[model samples]
Target: MAAKQVKSRQRVADHGEVFTAEREVKAMCDLVKQETERIDSRFLEPACGDGNFLVEILTRKLAIVKKKYKRSAYDWERNSLLALGSMYGVDILLDNAKACRDRLYEIWEQEYKAVCKKECNDDTRAAARFILERNIVCGNALTLFCVDNEQQDTTEPIVFSEWTFPFNDARIQRKDYTFAELINAEEPKRPKKEGAQQTLFDLYPEAKPEPDEEGIFLQQYITHYRRLSENG
Candidate 1:
């Protein structure tokens, strides 16, 4: 059976909601094969309707994590979370945003259980959901603002958390920035940060990514990987 590309005629008329087929998604992701496989590499789908592109990227990233860390449950858990944190998505429809998060969580859960087995715990599961909740957003990608139940733009801006394992330990650092601001700033070249596998500026040099004149971010905090639910 073929993957359904159109959900309904109303969705297409209202929001132009059409999912990419599996074959096309895979082919598009294959174009960035190396980046998709890199555990900490960032990928954003501006209109990620039900996560066609994201799930493919996550599947590739998890395969790498499994291949490299299957021997160690600890490594598998940490790297898997890293892979989860690296993806971001936005969909105008609330249902699509929720579906995207659920799809991502299921993918991570399946691999986590297969690799960690007895080591799996609810805290880790909560942490994965936390990342998905933060990464997958319901908003208008054009306006960079969140949407209401009716999919109308709200006053609140769309803010994205930049997640990082800054200390080479269990601690995960999160930095918040408005999506519009991150896209507004630009640097001629990406900088290599001390602890960041890839900072916002590193992953997206165009991101001014600083507290100074170059860029302005919202909040910064750190917590244990499993306690990411404690974060905002």
Candidate 2:
């Protein structure tokens, strides 16, 4: 059956919200076949209504992770986290944003449970949910501002959490940057001085490194997950 395109006619008129069919989504994604299959390739959907595109991208990436790392629980968990981190989305509607995150988490949880079975637990599930909460944001992509949850009318700069994996350790380092700064990283900026050109670094400042205390907490969290998996 063809999925319902929009919730209501009023929504279509107000937000110009129309969902792409599954077939069309596949056709468009096929254009970037290589990137879609690559585990670490990052993709951002500016108007990701209910995450039709992001869901498909995650499915593809997860399939690759499964093929390569399914046998090792640690490898599978790490690669799965990497795959989830690579996708990002923004939607103006808060409900859509929440739905998208829920959908993505559901997809990941189902797969993890099926493959890992007894090994899948609450800690791993919570990690997946945490990644989705950061990745799929409720915001105005054009303004690069997130809607304040407490006050719907107010907006805050869209700060994204970036996760990095180190080769020597299992700890994932995190950094934060405003969406505006990240997107404008490559755009040419007006010269700071009359005769001087602006460098890329000047255009986009470095991401804020996580605080030392937070880093310690994050490592502890990961260690807890490892200990749970081992005890199981």
Best by TM-score: 1
TM-score of candidate 2 versus the correct structure, residues matched by position: 0.78
Angstrom error of the Cα, residue 14, model 2: value is 1.2
Task: Report the error of model 1 at residue 145, Å.
Answer: 0.2
Per-residue lDDT tens digits of candidate 1, residues 157-213? 888888887778887778877888778933223232345323334333443335566
Which tens-of-lDDT digit does each residue in 1-232 have in candidate 2? Answer: 9978888998899777899889999999999989999988999999888999999999999999999988987778878888888889988888899999998998888789777888877777777777788889888787677766542434466656665564334555444456765765422222223323222233223422236542221111122223322220
**How does each model score on lDDT?**
0.85, 0.72
Q: In model 2, where do residues sit more than 4 Å from their true spots?
A: 148-153, 185-232
Candidate 2 has which clashing residue pairs, if any? none
TM per prediction: 0.87, 0.78
Instruction: Give the Cα-based TM-score of candidate 1 against the true structure.
Output: 0.87
Model 1's alpha-carbon lDDT is 0.85
Error of 1 at 101 (Å): 0.3
Q: Poorest 10 consecutive residues of model 1 by lDDT?
A: 185-194
Query: Residue 180 in model 2: shift from native, Å?
Result: 0.6
The runs of at least 3 residues in candidate 1 whose Cα sits more than 4 Å from the true structure, single-residue gaps closed, are 185-214
